[model samples]
Target: MTVSKEQIAAFYSTDTLAGDRMAGIDGLRHTGIATFMRCPHRTALKDVDIGILGVPYDGGLTTRTGARHGPREVRNQSSLIRRINVATGARPFEAARIADLGDVAFTEVFSPATALPEIEAHVRAITQGGVLPLLVGGDHSISYPSLRAVTENGAKPCALIHVDSHTDTWPVFQGSKFHHGSPFRLAVEDGLIDPKRTVQIGIRGGQNITDGLDYSRDSGMRVMMIEEFDDVGWKQAAAVAREVVGNEPVYLSFDIDALDPVFAPGTGTPEPGGITMREAQRFLRELQGLEFVGGDIVEVSPPFDSAGVTALNAATLLFEMLCLMTD
Candidate 1:
């Protein structure tokens, strides 16, 4: 579908912070308030189909702490994004009523225990409004709460399409069960997702123990390590993901660490021998027709990023994900 002139005008004019500097598509990409591809910022979800939200809390980190800055850097890099997808000609802006809902407010940024509830509440509000949420996260830990919110307190379980280096199914770390490495496990325990219907891709790297790995296998999740991904190829992998999820309500969670450190070194836990950016794109594109209730791109640490490449890649992938929803 063509992006109407009215849509372009509304999008460019939506960010009032720029104050007349941006009036059309001719406006500078770098000069506006960075709101997820320069989309209009709206707190109220009236008539909104998709809400791009930022969860900027990283208190659940087990190691690196820089992912708290992920959302802002991603937004800045997302300014370079245009409205159309060159690969599939998907015009998300025209296909969906999308807006940048801005970042989730945290009253206790330093406490994951308290802050996580805030994440749940915020996302719950979005879903309750009948809007599909596309969240930009602070870390993988945010997924636990996000799943709870998206599934309506686990009353409705969804299939999962998880792309990450680690299974993130480990038990408590340092007496903390809410760390980034355990969100999926926590989600499963709470019945937020169907483990048999979940597909975890691009899992590689050695671990301190086999608990998370064993848990993922024992729980009946389709764990495709990087080796299997290499053997079966992305197309086949995409096929498995599609077959497993079927037509169920699905949530796609992409941890930047799923990409090789060379492609995404800005993550807190960078794993080598992961998938390439091209492979990631193709895999996501293959997931076009699935019913996605919500999705997130997490673990983008701008401080560790070299020349903002990671954030740029994340922004591009975010666009790809948005295209999937549009499809």
Candidate 2:
């Protein structure tokens, strides 16, 4: 095939209003400074130079190592999908003002004990301004604080839709009550989330033997195992989710380990039999019409990743969630 000059010119064009800024079909406008304030190292790596924010805090990891570096790795490989509005023909930024909002600020490095409160404060400021927060990395524990902030301003408890490989409802781990494995339990116990309106999808791992299953059931949370998911399919699952959540505000929390290790190996916890990338996409796309308050993509450990595949997948999933919210 021969290249055409006209096509080349269209692809290489710059924006006049943006003045020396790169232009794309999506017409995305970068605004706000919340992300840069979260983590300077990650902000510089992703948003400052590359026009993206990659957060890499993994202190909440319970099973594996190096999830703290997830943001950096995911951003490095996220360039694969540079073109915007490629899926739904709707520009996300145009629909609603969006920004990276960076990673949660950790008071003490690798100290889940101190990080939760800090994350709550950061997200509260973002939501207060009416800007939709798109958070990356750290771990599933990060969502607990984010949820607390979202509902802080007199908002009632919202439905929670968690896509993960583990239930993450353990009462406590070691001597710490704030581990990644126990965020949901803390949230529900604290009245930040409604367990009756909550659903945990794609849970299939050995941790079930260690009280994960028991805790989820006792807490009144709906658990949709991966084996059952294979039997019923995502469309039916989405219908069930809609039925449970109704018209209330909702939060979508995605842990990369919810996906099969082959699809997302660079996570704190890797399970063999998990949701495929396609199934995950189908599940997320089905939430198009729901009233989503906020969302997060967590647990991307860059050290274990080969060629940044896991981070790229995480970033793409974040983009898809954004599309669902804005579309």
Candidate 3:
């Protein structure tokens, strides 16, 4: 029997234009409040594999204060995301129980001591529920507290894959020790990450001093500079990373400033010569089979973002992390 053209067209029809009851193909992308990839927003973390948490305090930023707005803007712009990884044939939403837990609240004015503890508690609950925290950051400092939450529960310190332009391993900046520049240093001090298993990739630009790089080396992290990264290429870099972080629970922290200013200009500390966004994507995709316990994409200062490129870079990087997690 031949199927009528009207019968085939009926499969695509929506019963109403109210946009309330539609699901599957009849649904619209921008029709509702934006969550991560339009996943359902749930207050509870029960039975979830991946939980998206946004940290909205940028008190730790040394240069610009706009990263506090990163969460809101990233969420607003993520309405454009769909659930599949087209390159790798990964269906992240299908592979895991994912939900957006919304943003963590902080004091009106930013305070690291106050906000860090709050962020830790929020992530602790997610980890307690056996959910992997896919955090969006207020700044790179947020990762330190976040690491505290995930590892503070008597779990062995995990391996870290830190992608950034700066080492962020300084013991302290000036007199203060709680800024974004000092997260991993504090993490190392707290024994929250095994520096032996840690690998920091794509570090570039000049610092006033080389103390941070020296510290990272002395602490046993594999620091791959931009020149070294380009010479070895993504495959060898990824291979070295995989070997260093082998079989351990891994926390992937991506700083948007790791990309050059041209591709991702909205970050607070962007360097001139860095990886391209596509290179970053391929580099991330190359490590698909690792054990990614929790991860974050940080320093997406939306106020500095022109053409929405930085936030978009962040959102897309979040997708890469999501794809890794699901893998």
Q: Can you give the lDDT of residue 31 in candidate 3?
A: 69
Candidate 1 local lDDT, 1-327, one digit each (tens): 599999888977764633123323646788866778887788989988999999998887777779989999998998888877888999988898878888998887777889999999999999999999988979999999999999988899999999999999999889989999999999999999999999999998788769999999999999999999999999999999999898899999999999999999999989889999999999999998899999999999998999999999999999999999988
**Tens digits of lDDT, candidate 3, 1-327:** 498888767745844322122222325776666666666677677767899998887888889778988887787667677667899998887888778788886654456777788888889888888999989988899998889988964366999999999899976676789988889988998999999999999998887868899999999999999999999998888898999999999999999999999988898887999988998998999999998879998999988889898888888889888989998
Candidate lDDT scores, in order, read 0.91, 0.71, 0.84
Task: For residue 76, give model 1's deviation from the true position in Å.
Answer: 0.4
> Residue 61 lDDT in model 2?
73
**Per-residue lDDT of 75 in model 1:** 89
Candidate 2, residues 1-327: lDDT per residue as tens digits? Answer: 487998778756833221113223322323312222111233222222112234455667767778777765554454344445465675554554444435555656556666677777777766665555666767778778878888883356889898898888887667877878887888887787888888999988886456878878787888999998889998988878888788889988899998899989888888899888888887887888898888888888887876677887887787778677877
- Name the top lDDT candidate: 1
Answer with 1 or 2, whichever has the higher TM-score.
Answer: 1
Candidate 2 positional error at 232, Å: 1.0
Stretches off by above 4 angstroms in model 3 are 1-27, 107-109, 153-155
Instruction: Score residue 44 of candidate 3 by CA lDDT.
Output: 77
Local error of candidate 3 at residue 97 (angstroms): 1.4
